[model samples]
Target: MHPAHPLLAVTHPDPYPYYAALAREQPLYWDKTLGLWVASHPTAISAVMRHPAARVRPLTEPVPRGLCPGPAGELFSRFVRMNDSRLHTRIKTLLMAYLQAQSQQACTPQWPAITLLSAVQADRFLYAAPVHAQAAFLGLPDQLHADCAVQIQAYLTALPANANADLIAAGHTAALTLQDRLESHLLAAEASPALRQLRDDGARDGIPAALLAANLAGLLFQSCEAGAGLLGNALILAGRRSLDASTTPAAARTVIDHVVRHDPPLHNTRRFMGNAIEIQGQRIEAGQTVLLVLAAAAMIEPDNAWTFGAHGHACPGQTLARSHAADALLHLLHAGTDAHALASHFRYRPLLNARVPQFDFSKDHQP
Candidate 1:
C-alpha cells in the first residue's frame, strides 16, 4: 500500500485532493499493493491515456478470483471488457453505428418526453423518473423499468466496501437476469427499421445479441448513474448563480459542459501497459496497469479541460451528451423552476468514480 494512496480506503468520496498532491510530488507514482500507476497531471494523464504502449485490456490476469466468481466471472470473460486495439476498435465502430442510429431516432424523440415526465414526477418520485425514461428509450416496457433500476442499484450497492457476500450474489443474479431480459428485447428489435439498417450496413458484423443487450443495459445503468450526477451538479451550479428562467439552451449547455469537465462521469479509466515504455521519465514495464484520473486531470488545467484527447480518443459522444443535458436544463428553465431552489436541492453522489449529485425535487420545488 502506498501510504499516501487515497484509494486504499473504502469510503474516499473524492480522490482529487490526493491526486493533485501526487501529480505535484510523484507524477509517476506507483502503488505496489494495487500494482498500478496513478497519473494526475493533464499532460501526464493525456500521455498515458493516448500512449501507444498502453494496452486497453481487462484486469483478467492476477484476478481477484474471489471477487467475481461463477457466472459473473464467465460473463466478464466472454464480454468485450477484455478487448484491445484491433478488436476494440472494430467493436467500437459497430457499436458507434448503433449508438448513432439510436441517438438520432429514439434519443432525440424521447428527450422532451423524458424532461416533461421528470418535471411531472419531480415532487412525487424524483429519481425514478429519469431511470424510467432511460428504460423507455431502450424500448423496455414500463413495468420492467423499476425492476431494471432495482437490479442496477443492487449491483452498484454490492460494489462498495462492507458489501455482504449475499448482496454480491444477489447483484450478480440480478445482472444476469437483466442480461437475459435485454437479450430477448434485442432479438425483438432486430426487425425494427433502425436496427435492421444497422444489421444490413455492416458485413463483418456479428454483434452478438448478448453483446447488444449487455451494451444497452450498461448504457442505461451508466446513464442513470452519471446522468443523475451531472444533472444534480448542474442544478447546484445554476442555483448558486441564481440563473434566470430565460437562460438560453446554449448557455445552459456551457454550464453542463463545465460541470462535466470539472467532474466527469467517470473519475478515471484503467489501462494495462502492453510493453515497456517511458512516461514522464519513468519506465513502466509490460503488463503493469496505469490508472488515468480524468476528473483530477480536468481540474489541473481548467482552461483546456474540454479536449478529450489530442488523439481521437476524445469522447465522440461529447456533442450528443452535451446536447441532451442542455435540452434537459432548458426544459427545466422553461418550466418556470426557480434557479435558487433548483440549486439548493443539488446533492452529489458520494462515489469516487463519478461526482454526481442527487436532486431532491420534492424539497426544492414549489406549486
Candidate 2:
C-alpha cells in the first residue's frame, strides 16, 4: 500500500516508485493534510534551500521549547546543524578542515561486540556500531566508545516533548557528562595535531570551547540513527544479492556505496521560512515550512547527494559517515552475521525522516 503521506513514506515498505512519481509530476505542492508545503523535485528543493530567509531553525523558538532551561537544550543549541548563529560559518569551516585532515590518518573503529548474532543483537549493533566508529574517529578512548552510544541514546530519548521526567533528567545528566568529556579531550595536551589545530583556530576566532565540544559530541549524534539506517539498508541490499562473510572488503564497500545512492538513510529534511517567499510559482508565507524530499530528488540526480543535503546547510560529515557505515558493514559480515536471514525479518523504525530497521520486534508496534 502507498504511504498516507510523505512523512509516512519513510517507513513504507516500498516508497521509491512513489517518490519518483512525486519528483516527476508533483514537484512542489501544498500538502494540506500535513499543514505545509512539500518539495519533491530537485529544482524546487534547491530553490527553498538556497533562499536566505529560509532558516534551519524557526525564528521564534530557536531551541526546542521542551529542552529549554536544561543542559540538554544548551547542548542542542550549540550544535552546528541547529542554528545559523554568528559562529556557525567559522565553526563549520573548522570542523570541515579537521575532519578532512583527520581522515588522512589510519583509524579503525572498534566495532561493538556481540555475544550472539540474534536479531536482538543486530538491532543493538546497528545503532551502536556507528557511534562507536564516530567516537573512535574523534580519537576518543576505545573503552568509552560503548558508553558514548548509551549516553547518546539516553540523550535522544529525552528530546521529544512527551518524554517522562526521569528520561529528561537522565538526558540532562548525560549531556553534561558528554560536554565535559569532549571539552577535556579537545583541550588535552595529548590531542592529535588535527584536533589541536581545531582548538587553536576556534580560540583564535573567539569561538567558545564549550560550543566546540558540544559539536564534537554532535558528530556522534549525527552519525547514530542515520548511520544505522544506512548500514541497515545496505544489509538488506546485500541480502538480496546473497552477500556473505566471504565477500571481499572491496565488494562490501561497493554495496554500501550503492545503498547510499539508491536507498539512503534520510528520506527528507525541512526548511522553515523566516520571510514570505515564492518558489516554483507558489507563494509560501513566513513561518511556513517546506519539506524537502531528498529521496525524491535523488531519483532525478543520483550523484547530487541530496541525502547529505546541498547548499550551506549540507552535511560536512558526508564522507566520514559513508566510510563509517561501509566499515561497520564489513565488520558485521566478518562477525558471521547472517545478513540474508536478518534482513528477511525486520521492519523500519518509526522515525520522521530516517529509515533505520529493527530486526527484533513484535508485530504490535512500529520502531
lDDT of 1 by residue, 4-42 (tens): 553432124454566556666766678786678887677
Task: List, in order, the clash count of every candidate structure.
Answer: 5, 0
- 168: Cα error in model 1, Å: 1.9
Clashing pairs in 1: 229-356, 347-357, 347-358, 348-357, 349-356
Can you write out model 2's per-residue Cα lDDT over 295-322, one digit (the tens) per residue? 9999999988778999887998888888
Worst 10 residues of 1 by lDDT: 108-117
CA deviation > 4 Å runs, candidate 2: 363-367
C-alpha displacement of 28 in model 2, angstroms? 1.3
User: Which residue pairs collide, candidate 2?
Assistant: none
TM-score, cand. 2: 0.97
